[model samples]
Target: MRVHKLTFAALAVAASLPLAACQSSGGGKGQSDPSSAAASTAPSPSDSKASDAKSPAGQGTAAATGSPANGKVDKCRTDELEITAKDNTIDGDPDGTVAVQLKNRGSRDCTMSGYAGVDLKTNSGPVSAKRSGEQAGPAVLKPGKSVAFGINYPVNNSGGSGVRITGLLVTPPDETKSVTLDWPGAATLPVTESPGTPVKVGPIGSAGQGG
Candidate 1:
């Protein structure tokens, strides 16, 4: 009887061994989930930084295209002049001061004289205003290069309604090769003189306030 009992005990112990091995091999309740483990490791700082950099605010497109200091003229057609207006400030009068930036993204350099000043068109006709700087061109802007024209005027009598800059004329110094610049529309920027203000207008040719 004793010998038979000992053999039975050994057989029971052997059966339990397989159960232990199965549990160790992920067949048990405490088995690890691979995906959850990876998430817990956390992402690196570099990865987080890259995501933030792609944001629009970081790229400086919060309002318009191009640099914040300058206004960008969009969709300039071939053979037509392009002007982008920026930094508009209207004081007590509707007509204040503004900076008109011009660019010659064309193949050939734009050699012109007497570029047209900004005009406020109304029902009667085009209301002509004077810019402090010279319209005289020959301001030779190479391909992809840009030049700015500083203009200051009273916001008063700027057409009781909306106004368009209309067009620009490029009269070359050598010959009368004139190029008509089509207006892409107008951008109304707030007028402010404070350091933190978006639009600032000061003296001409004072390190960026140039025409």
Candidate 2:
């Protein structure tokens, strides 16, 4: 009977050992799952620093390109310009050209563009002058610099009507007042009795050899 009691006690202790081992393994698995979840939720330090570095460079580039709100400049004034005419008469040609030079006499920079209004004047009244149909772009004139234009017309070779031109009446672009430049040397301008006659005037360009 004692031997049977010892055998029963050993069986009970052996079953209890497996149950204790199972409880220990379950607690270990639960702790390992929570540790893995914490590692996945945390943010990386390297990724946060890289995002901060790129923001300032983009903002700096935008500020550099956007200065100067208004884009247009001021127009040129007439009183600041000095006007003169140069004789460019070629030999044996009926068509002649007079180069009109305009110098910027002001202290500041200005702009000049388009055709200059020109007319020939005699003792009686103004003669007819046609525009040369030359297109001009805007030209920026620095202080003391000059720009030129050409006045083209026919020479008076006919002996029928003796018309004399004493001076030139020049009007700058977008100006109300006119400037009168005297005829250089013995230069004579062609004259016609008809009204509204055309005188060819070229666009503003670089200063030529004469005037």
Candidate 3:
């Protein structure tokens, strides 16, 4: 009877040891590591795309406008001149002279005239040319009036190869406000042969925003 009782006690003790080991193992897994838990719940790549799609277009445009020198386009009075270049005047070679047109889009008749300067800058310094032109149209632009000015960059003295176009400084009569037709910008003027290069000239690069 005593031997049977001892054997039953030994088995019970062995069973309790396993339960104790299991309880200790459960405590080790009480909580997952914070870093791993966060990773599991993190947003997938597709979620980022979905978030971007919900963003407003105006926000993107605003970012673009502010990107260059905290860039803000100053509206000068009634007329706004839009300047476009034939080529980027950089990277690729220009077949001919880059043409720039100034149009007056305002309620009142406005004059667009100034010393259109082209400064081809290099590592050393800027090589500049000045050519001035004026509009022959009426003094007051009746809602829509346009004027065109073409500047032919001299190939012989252009100096550098990699080039960028700056902008036109448009000065009105009163000169209350000068409009800067800021362009795509400065680059090294490619070296090329001049066939019948018309003499071109303009003001040196001015630090002011206006003409």
By TM-score, is 1 or 2 better? 2
Better of 2 and 3 by TM-score: 2
Candidate with maximal lDDT:
2
lDDT of 1 by residue, 45-116 (tens): 887787887885666775565444543333333344455655445435454555566566687654544434
> Which consecutive 10 residues in model 1 have the weakest lDDT in total?
198-207
How many clashes does each candidate structure show, in the order listed? 11, 6, 14
Name the regions of candidate 3 deviating beyond 4 angstroms: 1-79, 87-95, 112-125, 132-140, 156-187, 190-211
lDDT of 2 by residue, 73-151 (tens): 5556778898988787677766777788888888887887887788888766776567667666877878888888887
In angstroms, give how far residue 113 of model 2 lies from its true place: 0.9
TM-score of each: 0.34, 0.59, 0.33
Error of 2 at 4 (Å): 99
User: Residue 156 CA error for candidate 3 (Å)?
Assistant: 8.0
lDDT of each: 0.48, 0.75, 0.47
lDDT of 3 by residue, 1-211 (tens): 9999999999999999999999989987996889988889999889977877768666888898877674333332423554443332333444234444444555444443344444433444444444544333222333354443444453433554544434544443333554555443333345435443232432211111121
Error of 3 at 44 (Å): 95
- Better model by lDDT: candidate 1 vs candidate 2: 2
